[model samples]
Target: MRELACDVAIIGAGTAGIAAHGAATKAGARAVLIERGPGGTTCARVGCMPSKLLIEAARAAHDAREAQPFGVVAGEVRIDGRAVMQRVRALRDDFVASVFSGLDAIPEELRVTGTARFADPTTLIVDDHTRIAAGSVVVATGSSPSLPPPLRPVADRVLTTDTLFEIETLPESLAVLGAGAVGLEIAQAMTRLGVQVTLLDPAGSIGGIRDPKIAACAASLLGDEIDLKLGATVESAEAVGDGVRLTWRLESGGQETGTFSRVLAAAGRPPNLSGLDLAAAGIACDEDGLPDFNPRTLQCGTAPIFLAGDANHERPVLHEAQRQGWIAGGNAARFPQVEAPPPWPAYSLVFTDPQIAAIGQAFDAEEAHDWIIGETSFADQGRARAMDRAAGLIRVYAAPDGRLTGAAMIGPGVEHLSHMMVIAVQEGWHAATFLDRPFYHPTLEEGLQSAVKAVAERTGGTR
Candidate 1:
């Protein structure tokens, strides 16, 4: 067995791990980055990249099917799942390659690979064979799809997001368990590809984290094709012949059973910390495998050890993990006194057929700030009306003095719109500045002008 030494050791090479490695190395610490997998993130491999590609393809197919609405007559549109999957695989490979290539420039002293686990707070055991000693260690283990208790024993026909990507063929009918971002994104993507989909959620509404009005718009966009089974308690799940059976109790106290060619378990994600042996490292874990830590520093219960990303459990998103990892990595390398890290940025996005993005405090205007709310609907945007894609709204929360506090968008361009909101939230910019900036006319972005003006008007002035 070989022994290695490093100033800091970072386990896992996903978004957070990579960010930490970069920050640690830049901080003049000798860092060792390790991963059990040979390549880059699951996001690049199967999760975000491939899934989003498939969703974009599904959107194109949906547009073709609705050609008549655009005054363009076209023949029947059909998607070859095999071909689509092939393209997705190619894109996944390219993304992974790009990530790996970027890592090559990091100093040779700062990276290593193979399965790594804590032998002690400052010692990492690699591949169950080699041992590496370090001044500090940062854990960035990511998460895996959560399997529902009742469906745990079911086999084959039942799948999760991770398993679904490797499927040989798309099922004719799919029943998705959980109406969170994962379930809705996949369900809608599949529906556009001609698969009958049913979405089930325990909450009364879909997109639990989103504004209810935005979720209603999503429900409307899905039309009669996607079934909504809200406030349903799953009773049992079992495999029957080539399909699976699910019996659930509805919110009205009625029990119903349904069968589908495939059942997708998209019920959030559980942290990937089972093998890390937190006890040996003197780290404390909550019941859900999350580490006890300071939300600001991400330092675990013990010294010389920090946890970030999905393992820390504060929030789960690439951006959040990446930022937290940088803080943890820098703090671990610096060891004792250091400048205070920035407060965690709160933002989330759900990319369904109609995207929803939100950042900062919501529903806490009085507590967060003395405020005025500015709002605009997609219906008022020229580009939205011209594309016939208007199905949502944008709202900005501002202080009585016009300082922006929060921003949310639910409709086309929402993903891109979040960047502008991020700037406003980060800089504490005046909401009225958006109106004076002058966006190009005949575009969705011009809606920001309307939103800003509405907020200014409410705050006792018109921009």
Candidate 2:
């Protein structure tokens, strides 16, 4: 067997693994990156980039259809599903190639093209042929879609984020399972693309928004474009002809059934640690098989071993994965002298039409009792009205001292607006600070000014 040595060995070449590899090398540590498949990250190959391409196409089609309401008649719009999908795949391949170009620039010997298993705390066996003796290991194996129990039997009939984009043609009808970010985004995009889409979620909210007011607004707006079955649980799923039939229990004590051309399951994602042989490395895992790790440091219970990205299951988004990778790689390079940096404030955004975003404390947190709330409706906002998207709301929260604590919004531009709140919460900015900044009129941002000022006034600040 071939033998190699390195200061740090990164498993999986996804977003986190790639970031860790770069950080370790930049920190003067000899790093080796291992992977079993093509080296493109998930976002580039499947998750974010390709999905956004499809959503953009769907949005364009939807916008053209809705243009008639503005007294500007657009001729009959027809969607060419095959052409749309081909374009997505073409652009997706280019993204994957770009990622490969970076990987190729790395020394060839440092890239291992095989699955790795833990032989010991500081040793990795790659495909039983080569052994790597590393001072530290960073596991960033990412995650896989989680299929629910009822859908397992008909798994072949269900599509996931990992497989949905590979379809040659869009389904005429789709029943989307789960109302989280993936489910809601795809449901809206598919609906706009002329698919009969029915979205089912056991939770009461859409896009995982915990605020009842915002959730209700999201449901009403999205439901207007598609069939949204909130507070509905899938009871059974079975193969029906070439498709699948699903029976679900509604919140109102009624059972409903639906058969669709396809079922896209966006249930959730679980850590991908199936065959890593982690026990050999003496890593302790929880009931759900997740390794215990420090959220701030990204280090596992075992010394010299760290978990980053979706493998830790702390924060599964791409940005969090990148941050965790940098921390884990730097700490792994330093080993026993690991540094713990202060954690960043939490922020998340869902790119559904009338995007949903949350920063810092969630809308339904118990601590909100001590925080003053301010809100604005987008129904009358000038920009929203002009764009024919005047159908959402924004809510901001501030502490007793008027410092911005949290904010959640469901509106046309909340994806970008949420970043403003992220900076406010992270920098300890007061509500009045937002007022001091100039907000251009007739923009969605002006609505945020109103919300911020309302919170400032409630906290006894000068209007």
Candidate 3:
């Protein structure tokens, strides 16, 4: 076996792994990056970029169809599924190419195109041939689409975020399992694109929004565009003809059945720790196969190993993954002398129409006594009315002392509005801080300002 040495070894050339590689090299450490598959980050390949492309196409088609309400009657709106998917793939390829170009800039010897398994606490074997003795290792292997056992038998008929974008033509109808971010986004997009879509979620809420009101608003809004089945449990899924037949039990103790041309399983993702042989490295993993690690430092226990990105299963969002990657890489490079930065406020967004956003501590009814609630309804907002998209709500939470603590919203432009709240919550800003900022008229952001002011006034601030 060929032997090599490096200061840091990074597995998986996805977003987190690439970020770790850059940080490790910048820290003056010799690092090697190993990737077993295509080297594009998930965002560029399947998760974010391509998904957004399809969503944009679906949005345009929906907009054209809805324009008749404004007296701007366009002829029958038609979507060529093949052409639409082709454009998504074409653009997706460009994005993936850009990522590859960046990877190509790194020295060839530093990049190994093979699977890596732990040989020891500080050693890795690549494809059982080349051996790497590293001072520290950063595992950013990311995650894989996880299908429930009931759906496994019909896997060939199921689509996931990882495989949905590869289809050349859209299915006539689809059954979307799970109403989290991926399921909601794709389900709505597919519905708008004229596909018969049924979205199922075992939870009472949708989009994983913690705030009950926001979750309700999301379900209501999305339900208008798709066949939403909340609080439904799938009993079984079987292959029937060329499609899938699914039987589910509703929360009301009733059974429902559906046969669809395809099934899109967005259930959840499992950490990609499967062939890593972590036991050889003495890394203890939890029942979920995730290594115990510090969220602040991204270090795995006290060992010279670190876990970052989706592999850690802490915060699987792209931004959080990149942030964790940097932390893990830096700590691995400067082992025994780690730097732990102050944690950033938590933030996440669901990209469905009337986007759902959660920032900082999500609102909980049981904890209502400790928080002051401020809210606004987009149904009456001037901007929402002008756009004919008036639906949903925004709720802001503050402590008795008037400091912005958290917020959840389901409304037009909440994606941008939530970022503003992220900054305020992270900076420890008071509700009055948002109220003091000027809000442009007939804008979605103005609705956020109104919500903040309402919260501030309720919390002893002068309006």
Output the number of the lDDT-best candidate: 3
TM-score of 3: 0.98
Candidate 3 Cα misplacement greater than 4 A, ranges: none
Task: Sum up the clashes in candidate 1.
Answer: 0
Residue 135: error of model 1 in Å?
0.3
Candidate with the greatest TM-score versus the true structure: 3
**Against the true structure, what is each candidate's TM-score?**
0.93, 0.98, 0.98
| lDDT of each residue in 1-463, candidate 2, tens digit only | 9899999999989999999998899999999999988568888887999999999999899889888888988999999999999999999999999999889888999989899999998999999888999999999998889888989989899898899999998999999998898888899999999999999998888887887788788888888888999889999999988889999999999999999999999999899897898899998787899878889888887479999998888978999999999999999998977888887777888888889898887776687778899999998989989888887899998889898888889998988788888988898989888788888878888888888888999887745
lDDT of 3 by residue, 1-463 (tens): 8888999999999989999999999999999999999769888888989989999999899889889768898889888999999999999999999999999999998988899999898999999778999999999999889887779889889998899999998999999999999899999999989899999988998888888888777878888889999989999999999999999999999999999999999999888997999999998887877788888988888899999999988889999889888988888899978888987888888888888899998677789888988999999999999999899899998888899999999888888999999999998999887778778886989889888888888877846
Which has the better TM-score: candidate 1, or candidate 3? 3
Candidate 1 runs further than 4 Å off: 105-112, 223-225, 364-371
Better of 2 and 3 by TM-score: 3
